[model samples]
Target: MTETSTEGTGTIEALSLVPKAEARQSMKDFKSDQEVRWCPGCGDYAVLAAVQGFMPELGLAKENIVFVSGIGCSSRFPYYMNTYGMHSIHGRAPAIATGLASSRRDLSVWVVTGDGDALSIGGNHLIHALRRNVNLKILLFNNRIYGLTKGQYSPPRRSARSPSRRRWARWTRPSTRCRSPSARRRRSWRGRWTPTASI
Candidate 1:
């Protein structure tokens, strides 16, 4: 195992001689007993499921997994996971995860953040973590609106639109390429009404 620093710099000093199958089983043992809780139609459900399913593939010991999240509707991720986790303050998940990732070589750190909690006030921390590549899996939930704040507009919202709607548009942009032409056309209707420049 190797130890890292809070500054996002580190080196792997030793190789684990653990066999692949044994390591995989060890990781699987770390999964927790909590039931997932997210809105029926919310994207968070998928994100959570994906993470949980993917985690065991790493084949690390259960003690090596850590999930940290900032406050938001999405921040509840830690509660649903069986592994070690921290439901941190608003917009501070990355910073907290960064520190943990830098200092703990045995742990696989993951940060779960939302658009409001991350981009709004935690933007600086997010950027630094990404740039430094601090051996973390940063899962950003970009729903556009501040769901925990009762559907309010978030920082990622466009300036020209209502805060609530602007966030939706911002979140949807990344999916445009994957969408069917008909879906893209439907989205274009909103573009015309709101003006593409606003987005």
Candidate 2:
């Protein structure tokens, strides 16, 4: 008598089987015990809550996520997250996050920065990261003023108020209509390819 292999049958059975239980993990699992220290009415609280709420959807291992931040009010993000993080110098979060993401593909890298911290001292770093398409998520909080620095005017504000009316006019132009044809082409290309690629 010949005996048939049960391995294929077992594999088929496993493939057809459904999960017996729902996920036990909750958003609270990602919540850090650290006290949220943002001032009342600060937008940081909303940003923090949004990040925490969205994080669980990634379903990543807690240790495999990293948050890097520059010196500013929003830079305190790394401290509130339960995952691994680094609070870096002013306007250096993008560079640090780029390094981390490039070196560790298994990790989810996020950079938390403020308008002044990123667009002022870190502008070059931010542009390079975006241009290179670095595998990092940047959360730039633009509150128009420097919150951590006691409400000083920021780079965005300076640009808006500068004597160069031409620059202000260019900046104020509607982005979608004002972009160059090359930029429009790039956007169209990305819109067509990214959806299928993501799936």
Candidate 3:
């Protein structure tokens, strides 16, 4: 939450104030009671495991961290983590995370979105968040297909556009196309991209 104040000089000020967690935390402490409901070999499971393992290293109280996700197979992430989170509308997780991070600076905000959700419907929100440099982390799951909607072609699908048949192939000569922008950002803004295997 935020509050605005006006001083004698007629200057307005917006303050970000959120209470910090007072208790120490562990990996088990961040596990929720809900069951993991993804498919047998879905990439979301691997991402979830990696996130769960990394959260404990943040050393923040469980209540101070928030994971916001959009509608997709990856959107079910909040249910698996025992923290403040919201499974929001399709392609709007970045917008929601923006508000939380802007108003509650004390909280650690994270966004979990898929290729279709982030690049198609939520592209505007994602770009604005990155442009503004919000204090949040956005994890874009690029599985190339809509896993939640049962194998629909996504925006990032590297397949030939033939009506008769569709097949997966490498879009660019090198797979480093995705990392180029992130690499540039790292050089200028100190943002690091943690590349995971096939997730």
Best by lDDT: 3
TM-score of each: 0.67, 0.69, 0.74
Stretch of 10 with least lDDT, candidate 1: 187-196
The C-alpha stretches of model 3 lying farther than 4 A from their native spots are 1-24, 161-164, 167-199
Root-mean-square deviation per candidate: 11.0, 12.1, 7.6
Position 48, candidate 1: lDDT:
66
- What lDDT score is found at residue 22 in candidate 1? 51
Stretches of model 1 off by over 4 angstroms after superposition: 1-31, 158-199
Give residue 20's error in model 3 in angstroms: 6.8
Model 3 error, position 60 (Å) = 0.5
Error of 3 at 158 (Å): 0.9
lDDT to native, each model: 0.63, 0.65, 0.70
Task: Give per-residue CA lDDT, model 1, range 1-199, as digits (tens).
Answer: 2233333234232113212335345333544677666777777766666666766766655566778999888888888877789998978888899888777655678788887888778877776665555566667776657775576666655443665555445443322111334323322111111111221
lDDT of 2 by residue, 1-199 (tens): 1011222232223212212213544578768888988888776777787778877765566777789999988888888988899999988888988887767766667788887888778877877665555456677777767776665566555345555543433343222211334323322112211111222
| Predicted candidate 3 versus true structure: per-residue lDDT over 125-195, tens digit per residue | 87767655566677888877777777766766655567543444434432322344643352213332333
Give the Å error, residue 177, model 3. 10
- Go through the candidates in order and give the clash count of each: 2, 0, 0
Model 1: residue 158 alpha-carbon error in angstroms: 5.0
- Candidate order, lDDT descending: 3, 2, 1
